[model samples]
Target: MAWALGANSNSPPFAPAIGANAISTMRAAFLIGIFAAAGALTQGGAISETVGADLIGGVTITPLAASTGLLVAASFMIFGVYSGYPVPAAFATTGALVGVGLSLGGDPAFGTYQRIGTFWLLVPPMSGGLAYVTATLLRREEVPETVGVPLLAAVVGAILANIRLGVIPHPERAQGSLAEAASFAVGRPLVAGVDVVAILATVVVAAVGFRYIRAKTQVSAEQGIRTFLLILGSVVAFSSGGSQVGLATGPLENLYSVELGLPSIILLGIGALGILAGAWMGAPRLLQATSREYAQLGARRSIAALVPGFIIAQVAIALGIPISFNNIIISGVIGGGLAAGSAGVSRRKIGVTLAFWVITLVMSIAIGFGLYRLLSTVLGIQ
Candidate 1:
């Protein structure tokens, strides 16, 4: 499941960078693998817990149950990955878990489903709207490249300051952000009900990002734009890993935590290795197929597409939501493409893709439930 999940999913978020020639395919794959592993190790904990425990109520997932559900989900995802169409891996995994939980007599987790479903519904318009605004800003005559590019960089930096990571000490599942850690290290001084140190840290990071992008632009506008795209893609890839590894590792969370008496980090590490291997072995081909053939975006449009994916991925990670990065990136691509006139975008393909997401979710649920029940009956385990 981890291997197929890695191969099928994480690569597309960075397709823009490779498609734009901002980075070599081999190098980008290498960096993506590394960053993805880093992200999984550092931030996969909360998401893993959410999936393994919170998604279904009253059922402690047995190893057999986990294996059954994952087998069903992974088989479907592998078919979609090879068919060269974007499949919603998150939907499959989430639905599979729900189905298997039901087979085990667990009650429906409507609250969790509601939260995830709402987020999934919002991805299209929110990502498209943001991408359109960013692309428009990049194309504006009044906003110089130096100012506009740096402004976006500053915004990313500000967001980066508040992203939670596993390395930060926390009371429970809630990890601390960089800004919070900095404030704690110095002395939590409140300025008008705000952490003074966190505010200062945010400002400093944002200013530094702004200045750095501006300086890069000063050196060479074209190179600077490419450089920013590469950076943005890398961030999106990292965020993708954090948001995605959970789908593969979530089932194993209960297996490790209960029976094996192992840490969740160990499961994350296992999934991370699978992601790294997938990125190294299979990412380049998928990257080429999606980027070169599907959408040939230039540097400006690529950046616009990536920025929203990065932000949305981070938001998903922070909220412990399992997200399909392809869904986010495709919406951004459509928005960015439309900004330059919709000549390159295909309405039919988009419609088909949306329909596939819903179908995958419903079908996975049915498959998981039936498969688990059948296996339990034949094996006399349940």
Candidate 2:
């Protein structure tokens, strides 16, 4: 599953950078693997919890259930790889889990479903709208390239200050953010549930980020732009690892952590390795695909696409939501492409991809339910 995911995800974040000739293909793939591993280790826990524990109720997930669910989900994703449509990994896994849970007589987790479903629905429009607006801003003649580009860097820096991570000083040793550490040092000042110190810290970081990007731009506009694209691609690639690893490791979360009395970090580490291997072994071909397909869009639109991808990815991680990077990236691509007018975008391709997403979700549910029931009966394990 991780291998399939790596192949499926290879195109979105780094491809545009490759398309823009910002970095070599092999180097981008190498960095993607390493950063993805880092993200999985640091930020994969919340999503693992959501997938393994919160999606189903009234029954514990047995080893058999885990195997069954993962089998169904992984099979669907591998099929997607050969078929050439990027399957929604989160949706496939979530549906398969739901199916196996039902087969085990677990009740539906309606609240989790509601929250996840709502977010899933909003992804297309929200990502699209943000990318559209961002692309438009970058193209505006009134806004200088230095100011506009640096402003984006500053926003990302502000967000980075608040991105939750599996780190020190978090309650239960689970998670905390850079902003939280800043607030901790300042006697825990808070106003309207916002950390005053954190805000100041984010402001300082944003200023630094803006200044650095601006300086880079002033030296050589084109090179600075390409360099920033490389950096942005790396950031989004890291976010993809954080967001995507859960789909592969989610089913094993309970089996490895609770049944074996092991730590969740160990489970996340296992998933991280799978992702690393997958990225290294399988990412080049798809990266080449995008090198051809995405080059025509140019750098600014690609930047617009990736900025929303980074923002939405972090938001999903903070909320403990299982997300498909494909959905967010494609939506952003479409939105960003539209900024250049209709010629750059494809309507039929969008329609086909959208249909496939729905089909993947529904089919995974049915297959998972049937497969689990058959496997359980045959093995007498449940």
Candidate 3:
């Protein structure tokens, strides 16, 4: 499960970087593997809990059911990896879990389904719109490079300041943002106004950093954009780990206690390893596909696309929502492409990918439900 999810999910964050030639495929994979593992170990718990326990009601997922759901989901994703179609792992995993849960006589958690579905529907448009607007602004001749790039960097920095990190909070409480963690470290109580201060400080620091980079003799405007895009790629990769690890580990949460009796951390570690392996071995093909097929993005357009991808991915993680990085990246790529005109975008490719996403959702559910019944009956375990 982790191998499949990792291969599919880990590629998009760095695809734009690759497209812009800001980073090499191997370097992106290496950075993605390390940061993604960190994210999984630190912040994977909430979404895992949501996937394992909150998606259904009235029954616990037995080891057999969990394994069946994961198998169905992973098989579909593996098929996508080999076939060169980017299937949405979130849709597959969520559908599979719900299917298996229903087969086990669990009640539908319609409210949870509604929340997840709403986000799934909203992310593409939201991400695309933001990227389109950003790209448009960046292309304007009147927008000075010094002011425009730094202002955008400031916004990204502000968002980063507020993102909840898993390693910076009390064990029993939810995570804290960088500012809150800093405040705690300094032995100051977290007041209501502290976030505003943190935001301002982050923006100022980012603005200064961008200004410095721009002033460097070796760093051209294009190079500055590349550097920023690489940073955004890393941020998005870390967020991907936080969001995608749950899809692999969620089903196994119950099984960890019931059968294996392993700690959650250990399960997370296993998932991280699978993700690392997949990122190293299987991610390059999809990375090439996304970077080349979706859009031909330059450094400015790449940054425009990646900023929203980073923000949206982090938002999904904070909300414990399972989202498709493919959806996010493709939307952003299309948005950036649209900034150049419709000619830059490939409608046929988009249609095919969307079709695959819809088909995978339905097929995964059916497979998960049918496979569980067949496996349980054959093994006489249910």
**For this target, which candidate reaches the highest TM-score against the unseen true structure?**
1
TM-score-better candidate, 1 vs 3: 1
For model 3, name the residue pairs that clash. none
| Ranked candidates, highest lDDT first | 1, 2, 3
Model 2 stretches astray by more than 4 angstroms = 171-173, 189-194
Give one clash count per candidate, in the order shown. 0, 0, 0
Q: How well does each candidate superpose onto the true structure, as a TM-score?
A: 0.96, 0.94, 0.94
Clashes in predicted model 1: 0
lDDT of all predictions: 0.85, 0.83, 0.83
Model 2 Cα lDDT, one tens digit per residue, 176-217: 788878888778788988878988989998898899889989
Q: Cα RMSD to native, each candidate?
A: 1.4, 1.9, 2.1
Candidate 1 worst ten-residue window by lDDT:
287-296
lDDT of 2 at 188: 78
Clashing pairs in 2: none
Q: Would you list the rank order by TM-score, best first? A: 1, 2, 3
Quick one: best lDDT, which candidate? 1
